[model samples]
Target: MTNPADVKVAVVGAGGKMGTRVSNNFAKSDYQASYVETSPAAAERVKDAGRELTDLETAVSGADVIVLAVPDIALGPVTETIAPMLQQGSIVITLDPAAAYAGLLKTIDGVAYLCAHPCHPSVFLERTSPEQWADTFGGQAAPQEVVAARQSGTDAQQALGDEVIRCMYGPVIDVHWVTVKQLAQLEPTLVETVGCMVGQFLKDVMDHAINEVGIPEPAVKAIFYGHVYIALTNALRGSNPFSDACLLAMDYGREAVIKDDWARIWDDEDLDRVLAKMLRLEKIER
Candidate 1:
């Protein structure tokens, strides 16, 4: 295993959202770390946080693990520019799997590519502190699991990558390993397309209750939030059986709000279609 103190880590987009979060963790870790940001505002954030910024070429050349924290749309060009400059056996980490799964990232023979995405703090977590409760996104005070994929690497290489992954997203529960394609499917398909869309739809419904139905905002929120927890626990964990009337209402909801063909989003063609749109490519070659 590579010693954490001996590892050299570079965060390429250290000023952005995920970049800042991971950078905060890395800055406090034992690894030799460099913050690299090109955006003016982002670079200032890095500077304000008391970290010296390194030039792109210098950081890439020296890093044992390079985190490409740039946006998905910028990944192709960014990797094309830096992949060749990476040291032999160095690991390049991406925060998302979209570009990697879509075959948009540039690759080199000796370097490894990894994608690790946070599973955000679980709703069921027993967070006792104010800080933990406030940290819904994880990494600061709340513990979160991560899902990761390695495109090319030996077990030893992967261990080193995992060490970095845990540190950058520390207070981590566990790192779940999956193939790049599987990670992609779990993300945009199951999580975003279905889960997040449903969450947003819930918000819309709440708004309709307050605005159109003229329910008191506080009363609506109080009832909705408690029921959200009950719904999740009852449906997902089988904590308690839902009431008979609730089941009837749920059946009505499924008929009214969901399409019978919604499961088709898990199909390979659908995955490819979503990935193409995500990566801004006309089609996925494979």
Candidate 2:
């Protein structure tokens, strides 16, 4: 068994908002924090947080786990650069596996490459309006309540819903795992079939409400207008930042919904129930 206190962790891209949050969280942990950031300002932030700011190559030295928090599209190339630098048995996991260059994540004989996404729903909740942020994460919406709800759910047929939820730093409302096969099939279809569809969804929703059929653009804007403000409520209410892997999953989910294509990419029953529950919660909050 590994001792949590003895574990050494490295965080790449430690300068951005998500990076800073992760770095800060690790700084306050019993584990040592080795920070790496391309931005000079991020390097200064690492020093200010009282952590060791090391070059990317040195940061992963002797570490048990390496967290790649870079943009989804850039992960593969970066991993290719660092694969030779890691020790055997090290685990390299990304916050979002959906968009990662999974093919580029070469594994040395003994290393474990796990692509994971964060389950925290509250992180997005933080990007909401200030007036309601307090109550959204306050007394009634405590972490314990979210945890309890998450415990009863399942992401894949292979694991308990609670076990999935428990792997996160904050509340993870739901998750959809992707296999290598699934990623290969879905990637080709995304650009033409999915991305444009999403843009159309946004535009169509706007066109309708401006006059009669759809919800008014003003009202739709108001909803997401609170997104930035409410995103913080998730963590404050006890949810952590949405993991990179989870964000990728959301990208896929949005694509799937827009294309009406739900097959091996995700589990339908689980997703529908989860979405319904989320909508219910939104209605209650509203």
What digit string (tens of lDDT, one per residue) describes model 2 on residues 86-134?
Answer: 8766666565433332234545555655554432334345434444354
Off by over 4 Å in 2: 48-50, 98-102, 122-168, 171-286
Q: Pick the candidate with the highest TM-score.
A: 1
Whose lDDT is greatest here? 1
TM-score for each of the candidates: 0.98, 0.52
Q: Cα deviation of 95 in candidate 2 (Å)?
A: 2.1
Residue 85, candidate 2: alpha-carbon lDDT: 87
In the range 1-286, model 1's lDDT, one tens digit per residue, is 6678999999999999999999999988899999899999999999999999999999999999999999998999999999768999999999999899888889898888999999999999999999999999999999999999998877777889999999999889999999998999999999998899999999999999999999999999999999999999998899999999999999999999999998999999999898889888899985
TM-score of 2: 0.52
